[model samples]
Target: MYTPKDFVESRLPVLHDAIRANAFGTLVTAGEGGIEATHVPFVLARDEGPMGTLYAHVARGNDHVARHAGEVLSMFTGPHAYISPNGYPGKATHHREVPTWNYIAVHAYGTAETFTDPDRLLDLLSRLTEQSEHDTGQAQPWKLSDAPADYVAPMLRGIVGIRIPIARIEGKWKLGQNRPAADREGSARLLEQCPGDNEQAIAEAMRSV
Candidate 1:
C-alpha cells in the first residue's frame, strides 16, 4: 500500500468497484498466534456503512473463526503485469527506464465479528452464490434452495459467517501513471499485444487512467 501521490485512489465508488470485480481476497488478522491470513471470496455491502461492509466465511474449525473479533485487513488484488522497459518509448533514446510492475490493489481495514445464526448464515451463502453465478453468465444459475434443506443445513453448520464493517479503505492503481505520457501509452500498447489475460487487463486499465 505504499502508493505515490500519482497512483493513490481514494474515490469510494472506484474502490468499491475494484473490490466487487475482484471478490476473492485475503483476510489478515493478528492474534496470540501472530498473523494469520485466509483466502476467501467476499461480498460487499456498499451502503451498509460509511465506507462499506464485507461479508465472508471460514470453516468452523478454522483458527481464524476463533480469533475473529478484532481489527482485520482484507486485501483485493486486480489485474497485474510486468512492465518491460523495452516497451517504453524513452528506452531507445535514454536507456534509463527499468522494469516495473503495474497493478490494481485495494486494502480494507475494519473490525470483524462472527455470526452463527442459521438464518443469517443462509442469507450470506445465498448472496455469495447469487453473485458468483451471475458472473458465470449461466442460464440456470444455482441457488441454495436448489439443494435439499437437510443437506444444506449440515453444510452451513460447518462454517461461520464473518461481517466486517469497513472503517477505512485504500486503493492503489499502479498503472504507469508516474511515467511520461508517451512512455505510458507505448507500454500500454505493447501490453495489449501480450498473450495473457493479466497483460490485456493492465493495458485496458492504463488506457482508462
Candidate 2:
C-alpha cells in the first residue's frame, strides 16, 4: 500500500481488529510461474508468532498452493467509501477540492507452509467452522462432527491446509485524517446517509477520529 504519513496506522490492536473483522483476505505469492492470488477466509493465531500466524486452506486442485514458497502476503480490506467533493464544506470557498476515497486495510507477510496430515486438516476445519459460526451469532451452530466421519473424511481429502507464521504487519486507515475538521465532518455526514454498510462504517470511523 502507498500509504501517506497521515494515513499510516501501526497500532497492533487496531490492526488485529481489522484482520479479525475482515477475516477473508487476498493471499498472494510469487513463484517460478510468476504471481498467483487466492481469495480465502483466514483464522488468526495471535499467540503463535511475534506478528501472529494465519491459517487458511485452498482446494487440492489449486496449483498456487503447490508453487507457493518463501514470503507470501495476505491483504485484509475493511470499510471504504467514496468522498465526493461536494460534501466538503470548504468546497464553496476554495472550490479546489477533489473527490477521494476513505478506507482501512492491513497487509501481513510471512513464510507459508502447507499441512497434509489428515488429523491436522480436520482440526483446522473444525476450528474454522466454529469461529465463523460463532461470529454469526448462531446459538446452535454447526460443527464438523455434525456430519458423518465418512463424509467429512472424503471431503477433507480434496483440500490443502496452509499456515503462515507472520513476520511483518502493516495497516492503513485512510479515513480523511489529513482533512480539515469541517471537511471531515461534512463528508462523514454524507457517508452516514449512504445506503451501503461500508459507507456507514466509514462514517463511524470518521466520527471516532
Give a tens-digit lDDT track for model 2, residues 1-209.
78899888998778988998999899999988899999999998888878788999999998687786789999999999999998898788999889998999999998889987899899899989998998989779999999999998988889999999988899999988998988889999988788999999999998887
Candidate 1 is scored at a TM of: 0.97
Over 1-209, each residue of candidate 1 has an lDDT whose tens digit, in order, gives 79999999999999999999999999999888788899999999999999999999989998585665578999999999999999988789999989999999999999888898999999999999999999999999999899999999999889999999999999999998888888788999999899999999999899888
Residue pairs with colliding backbones in model 2 are none
Q: In candidate 1, residue 19 scores what lDDT?
A: 98
Each prediction's whole-model lDDT (CA) = 0.93, 0.90
Please identify model 1 stretches exceeding 4 Å from their true place: none
Pick the lDDT winner.
1
lDDT of 2 at 149: 98
How high a TM-score does candidate 2 get? 0.96
Each candidate: RMSD to true structure? 1.0, 1.1
Best by TM-score: 1
Displacement of the residue 116 alpha carbon in candidate 2, Å: 1.0
